[model samples]
Target: MDITIHRPGELTEPLRRAWHRAMDESPEYANPFLAPEFAIGIGRHRAGARVAILREEGEPVGFFPYERDALGVGRAIGLGLSDCQALVHRPGVTWDAQELLRACRLSIFEFDHLVEEQRPFAEHVTGLFASPVIDVKPGDGGYPEWLRGSYPGLAKTTLKKERRLGRDVGEVRFVFDERDPRMLRTLMRWKSAQYRRTGRMDRFARPWIVDVVDHLFHVREEHFTGVLSVLYAGDRPVAAHFGPRSSAVLAAWFTAYDPELRYYSPGLMMHLRTAEAAGRNGVTLVDLGRGDKEYKDWLKTRELRVGEGFAARPHPVAAGYRLWRRPVRGLRNTVLAHPRLRDPADRLLKTVGTLRTSHRADSDGAASGRR
Candidate 1:
């Protein structure tokens, strides 16, 4: 296949349409991140993002949205800690993946979450990873029935709690596509606080994350859309889920609940509502994006393999860096590999968070009531 490189800003309507068509044609392609809107959104916000447009017989066949960084490093645009893969295209089209690197002038391409389907360039790959998902379709009666058949204990427990909570709170309601921006802000705030408490970096700290959220908020479509579902206890939002919804797949992306209301399990309730709505909307699957959460297994019927390994063009500069980076990566992996070390490492991070909070409090007290 003959592939041409194009600057992110230079993408045309035909190119975008072809890219979407290629992705739409692929059965394995269900990610919103692989969509043109997502790539364009990232390109508009992130610097140095470029699109590699592949062609055969003067017709577009594939598209990849990548960000060129210092040291000739390239990665999927907006792929920081995200579970989706890069280099999205139709099947049966083969090209020298290295040619793409040469076209883009990239040295090393790092992909922590690259898809396995694009393994033609596996020689240049770095690592392998698994992204877990749940198939929330069983044709019986949507989530409620699926849960009863799959996880009867959990279903019974959750329904019992739901009944108790509803009795206490007056009425429990689920709102989908809530038009208010305030609900999204509340979910972000809760998620941010959860990250801090759990010693994970707040993703919203990055400007692109904020822009992506705001962009998805306005992007509503049948197959590609952002659905914000909120569980309300007597009109007060208790839990909210911000995820991508499609005709057949509703991906569980981001979720959060009020800490004080954790006892009611509002998050689970919101998820239940989402699954029901997805079935009602002709959705065949609700993908709870890659993780080992017990709830996922309880709510899902099967798992799909998603993500890929990194590939790159052979450049001496990039080769040298990869060589040196290998040992460091190995050491880090080894450390994380040990369950003993991993647990302590996590604890240490949590301790550091507590200390940071204390120091911040002291500084704030010193500056308070001062102008």
Candidate 2:
């Protein structure tokens, strides 16, 4: 295999078409996060983003998108944001992991959501995770009928709640495809608040992440689209979601709801509505991503196994990087794997969050008094 590294923006039209063709040929590679457009979006904001193209007989055969730092430590492009990662290749094509890393000029390539079928990376994987997925089948009757049949209990209760929410609040409405950009901003704001309330890092705190989402919203192609779905009550937005979709797959990226309506379970409603709508819009599966959430367990028809690890070539930088990173990941994985451990960790985080919020409120009041 002949390898060539290029900035994602530098790829020619023929190379992009070849990348799409490779995805079309492999079911495992059919994710919008793995699409070339997504890489380009990241490359626009992230100077380190590059794609390593593999060629055989002078024809493009594979694509590996990654981000490398000055120290030679690399990560999958959109490392924390992308729910899928892989070296998308034609069927039966194979390559060495270390050789690919060398071609990309990397000492270590880190990933969290690598597809299980990528055998070349299998040896590098330290852990396997269950990424929940909802299999969407729009049969002769469509999503409504399928929902009733597949999850009668949930459908009955959720629909009743929807009715109650409408009667008590106002007309409850769900828009499968929302074109309004204002709603996108609303999602980020709510998500940012949610992060703070839960003692988590706010992704939207970064200007580049916000800009990247905005850029993706305008990307509409046959192979990839950024979809925004919203739920409302009497014109008041209560819940919203924004995610990327390929022709056959929709990844559940970001979803947020009004904190005031937590009792109504609007977040759950948003997901159910999105799944129903997504199936109708030519999406075959809704990837709920790698996490242990009750809602994911309640809704997923099945789960796909993903992996997290560092693929490295023997080097001081690679060894040092892994040594520093592995413990942090190990602690997180241990907590997630056991509810007994996860519960206490969650309580501690919530306490910290409560304290943080109150401190901010106090500071605001002090400033107001000064004014």
Candidate 3:
């Protein structure tokens, strides 16, 4: 087996085509996050991005995308934002984890959403998580028929809300693939505000993340495409979702709604509408990601197991990195795994968020008065 490392941008056309073939041949690797285009997109914005190509008999068989710092500390490309992570490879392709790390010049490789079929890294896994997914199948009669047949209880209530929303706000409508850029900006603003209210890190506050999303929105490819879905009521955007889609799978990424219309359950409506449209568009699965949200419980047809851990070579940097990072992840997992701990943590975070939002508003008001 031969291993070579290169910047994602340096990948030749043949290599890119081989990568696409690898994705198409494996059901598990069909996720857009694992696609070469996604890696290239990240590489375009992040200076540390690199890909390790594993070859045999002069043919590329595997691709591993990651980010490395000067200290040889590494992470899966787009770790926090990407729902699926893997060393996308053809069947019967395997490599020594240690050898791969050495070839990439990494002391430790950290990942949170590692795919389950990655046997080479299995021994290094620290935890297994249930990632919810919706299996999409378009009914012969369309969305209403499909929803009624699949989720009768949910359909009744959600449909009622849809009707009410239309009567109160104008006409409730959905666009599965909205091409408007202004609506994308609206999604970012809603998502950013949602993060602040939930005391989560505002991803859009970072310029690079914003740039990446904007760049991806325009990407049109056979293997990967950015899909923006919007749900509107009387010409007003009620909710929106922006996620990446491979040929078969749509990853449920960033989703947000008008908070003032929370009573209308626009967020849930967005997910349902998106799923229906995705099925019609030939998407076979919707990966809702690895989280224990109530909405995920309601939407998922089944669950897939993902992993989180560090694959490391025997080095001081590797040891130190593990020592520093493992405990933080452990603490978070513990809180999330148990509602007893999670509820209080959530309440505390919300309290902090309320305080933070109020302070910002007060500051803004003071500035306005001064002006």
Candidate No. with top TM-score: 3
What would the TM-score be for candidate 2 when compared with the true structure? 0.98
RMSD, candidate 3, Å: 0.7
What's the CA error at residue 110 for candidate 3, in Å? 0.3
Residue 341 shift from truth in candidate 1, angstroms: 3.8
The clash numbers for all candidates, in the given order, read: 5, 0, 0
Ranking by TM-score: 3, 2, 1
Higher-scoring candidate on lDDT, 1 or 2? 2
Encode model 2's per-residue lDDT on 1-371: one tens digit a residue.
99999999999999999999999999999989999999999999999999999999999999999999998999999999999999999998989998999999999999999999989899999999999999986656754576687678798888788888899899988898898999999999999988888888899999999999999988899888999999999989999999999999999999999999888899989999898888878999999999999999999999999999999999999999999999999999999999999999998888888888899999999999999
Query: Over the stretch 150-269, how does candidate 3's per-residue lDDT look in tens digits?
Result: 788799999899999999998988999999999999999999999999888899999999999998899989899999999999799999999999999999999999999999899999
lDDT of 2: 0.93
| Model 1: residues with Cα > 4 Å off, grouped in runs | 138-146, 306-308, 323-339, 369-371
In candidate 2, which residue pairs get closer than 3 Å at backbone N, Cα or C atoms, i.e. clash? none
TM-score per candidate: 0.89, 0.98, 0.99
Clashes of 3: 0
